[model samples]
Target: MSVDSASGVTVPEPVPAGVVLRPPDSSVRRNQRLLARLGWLYSAPALLLVAAVTIFPIVFSVVMSLSHVTVSGSGFALGGFTGSNYSAMFGAQLWRYALEFTLAYTFGTVLVEIVLGTLVALVLERLTIARGWLMALLLIPWAMVTVISAELWDYIYNGVYGVGTSILHDLGMQQPNLLGTPTAAIISMAAADIWKTTPFVSIIVVSGLVMLPVELTEAARIDGANGWQIFWRVTLPQLRPTLALAVLFRILQAFGLFDLPYVLTGGGPGNKTESLALLGWQTMFSDLDFGPGAAVAVSTAALTLIGCLLFLKVFRSQVGKEEL
Candidate 1:
């Protein structure tokens, strides 16, 4: 095809087969590829750190749990392993008691914390004055170092000069040493935990409460729903996910409780307050039995992981139903 300039008439150019003319600049594609590579390079340090800190320790612990290794004893090699540690733990009566006590303590503390925390959150949310100061005051217990909190509580529960006993006596209540008896010790531990962690749960619940759409509650109110009815029918369902997450975290924290019980009761008056973590610590450090202790520690980790997964699954299911 050709065009004649003088005649001002043009003939169409023939299209070439399988030929295409595209824009020349490929910098955008090149930059995208470059960026992808840079991202991986930037993330390498974090990935390496995680592997070194988290993955290596987890693998080492698993290996240690299966072998007979102690502070003075080293008969078993790392690669050469046995199931004796697990077998011994499973065959023991003390293991059962440890498990039961751990479960009881975890459940009791978490339950009380959640209930009290939720109620506090509700009241705080409804309050129009002094809420900020109250929240700050509630956080003081949480802010204290765990060991310090334990020591403080220990002084308060002391038999001779303890304010707790004095106050009880003043109220016409006969009070023994708080940590002397098993039941009382467990109750005391739970009280300390509730005092420390209820604020944490309240913070989580309060966030959810604040994020909730007010229209739903107002609509329910307009429909003549009572306060309790509105709460059960509206508020509770909305808060389920946050509550589950908070409770899951609390359960894990309570299950691994050591410092408070250690300082308060020394896991004593006998092994009444002895949790699985404390038992594992005693086995590893005090008794110098690394193999058995690592096994116990591994079991605790596995159980905690399972509990968290179950909680998340249940929470997801509930949230899904609510969404539907």
Candidate 2:
């Protein structure tokens, strides 16, 4: 016990018992830990669902790749495991062609879309009036679904009834089969993709344009710089980060290149336009070679992973510059 000198009252002092009182911060720490656990409990279901849908299939296929699995009358069983699956996947000539075509298609479409979309964005950003209507017109192509747009293009390029054929016939010359030859089919498919997806790029560029500083452009104009000079120096560099991000988005989507090629070319004209995704699908589903098919799927995933990693470096550069 202790005595207060002023009040002359006895007060309880510290107890020396074995039970120790927790400090306020310790109590708070305990409460935070409890809440964190509860948060994880709440999130567990979603995490499990994602694992089931995405992680499980990837792991399963990886396992399948190591086995001699085939779509036989017997059920799937793991035995005769060998590296032959990878050998078959890499040894094939068709797979190489598909891979090359996929790369070409991705780059081809992305290049055209970026150029065209940037041009459209520049034009729209300079307009003084009716941009709302113009924006709507711009989004029309992007709003249409990819498969539908591809099918539309397929009809447009139809050998017999297409507009191109009609025009050629009117000119009194041989109606060149647009989708019948390998090079023409690939070019036609790329054109369809560019037509459908360019508006999306334009939307991204336009968003970046809206955030651009008018003062910079004004200063350039005051310094007696021409329109082309100002835009080439000021506008394009400002848009690079957004352009990098947009390219990543488009490349991821374009590298897959499944439904568009499927609907338009059917990997036709002797499989000249087969994308990696389509080839993987055809191998896994159509041919029923589970081992080699899984290998194809893995290889495609690796290919995409490399592309994504490369873009991530560019994205990181953008982020670093912004942080500075």
Candidate 3:
């Protein structure tokens, strides 16, 4: 056998090593591929939904703004084209009224919310008893439906049998019709907004307050810092980011406000409370002028974007300085 093996060029026996080779399981590879595909499949519905709901509408609106469309006619048809809508908006004095009212509304509401919200936050921070209950109660205004709050405040500002009128009479003053006069109506609507939304701003600021390091405040106190000094130097610096965020949110909300003003004032008393949104609504629905209405909406959106960008830039600068 040995002689025969040499003659046939026999091969040596294989030696055992530390390593082994094996084929990957086809099932495992298939399962991994299937899982990856399934993950994407699961997310497809949400992506499609977002595209359909948000992206589609935005694109449609942009296109509609460039063309003329009527609510009663074929929706967003391309044939009814005109630049006259935007030209009319720019040339008319109505734009000035809308702009002035929008600015007034935004500033009035945001200013009140910030000041009153900070005050409330400070009060909440100082409280030691039933703080949770108080916080919950403060949130009630924000939790209520916006339309309901508008109606409630509307009734409160009513000339006869209104609580506001009653209070004025009790104070030995003639009860002025708050919702009738232009100045008073604007102030009254803004006050209603402040009452409803200040709690939201307070909640944001309170979170910032709660997260502030006690050590910094204590150090300030040990350095003989008074209440005002501590607040200005130690507390406010830490809360700048929160305050920025709160103000930005409040501003945006106040800028786009429609339902409350619509429900309460109906943009009445000589268009004193007519915000950009309300004006757009009137143009589109009341006048059946879709082109101008869409133009107003587009302009409003651009203004909002500019405002937001400015806020973000300022916020980033402040945050950077704070970090340093």
Candidate 4:
């Protein structure tokens, strides 16, 4: 005999017709329902805090970018709404140069980091002795504070008392100021960043390597693959995602380079090493041009976001290829 549900039509029941057949009582079910709701209640505070800090600043920046906000005679004033701030950013050659410099800095540093970091991770993976201590040693530079490291490099690059200057004179050359030239200064800045962040990239890559399937590699070896061949066929494809993540992170971090260049070059040598972040800071604080500064910040942030998205897109395609 068939019985209808609560919204019921007529039913032929095994028990009495009016007797509803409710599902069996379960403490587990009731507990699960309570826990699901409790989970949301617990997470609400942290989620709200994150939204307040992140969303608010991004919204405020976009808004300020649209308006001509300036420090007025008595106080800050919004000089109505216009896109002149962003237009000025585009028209100025300074901003364009800074943008190009930032891109080059990001590419150079991240490329070096990826190559060196991967090599380091591979060496560590094959190490039979003192790997843990060696990993710790590698992490020391990464743990050092950015400003302190930059200052240390600046001292080394000093025109008078610098190790660099001493070496130059010992080689019978004139006194050298590493930061006094455009190319040398840019290279010096990239070197400092590579020293600081390569360990970070290696650590992430090493984690991915740890999860790599040993059996698959062994199988490839048994099939007559050499070290490079097995790596090319087995390990590299597996590492694609991890490498993509490493590149994305370094790109974002290096694109905002300010502290190192500020300490080392002060954006001088014709402002050849000036980054957009440095420019934004100068505009906002040094020149006190709020509108243009916000616009710079907004444009840079947008560009970084696009870069991240593109990396993810390419990584996703690589993943699909692996599946096939």
* Model 1: colliding residue pairs: none
Q: Report per-prediction Cα RMSD to one decimal.
A: 5.8, 5.9, 7.4, 7.0
All candidates' TM-scores? 0.87, 0.86, 0.85, 0.86
Colliding residue pairs in candidate 3: none
lDDT of 3: 0.85
Order of models, best lDDT first: 4, 2, 1, 3
> What are the lDDT scores of the predictions, listed in order?
0.87, 0.87, 0.85, 0.89
Worst 10 residues of 2 by lDDT: 70-79
Q: How many backbone clashes does candidate 2 have?
A: 0
- What is the Cα-based TM-score of model 4? 0.86
lDDT of 4 by residue, 1-324 (tens): 564777567766468768877665797689889999999999999989998999898998888889978687797777678999999999999999999999988988899999999999999989889989989999999999899999999988888899877898899878677888998888878888999999999998998999998999999989999999988889998898889889988988888888998888889888898899999989988999999999999999999999889889988987998799
Return whichever of 1 and 2 wins on TM-score.
1
For residues 31-135, could you state the per-residue lDDT of candidate 1 as single tens digits?
A: 889999999999999999999999998888899998867453544345458899899888877777888999988888888889999999999999889988988
- Model 3 lDDT tens row, 221-315: 99999999999999998898899889888888888879877998899888888989898889888887777888888888889889899989988
TM-score of 1: 0.87
Give stretches of model 4 more than 4 Å off.
1-37
Clashes of each: 0, 0, 0, 0
- Where is model 2 more than 4 Å wrong at Cα? 1-23, 314-324
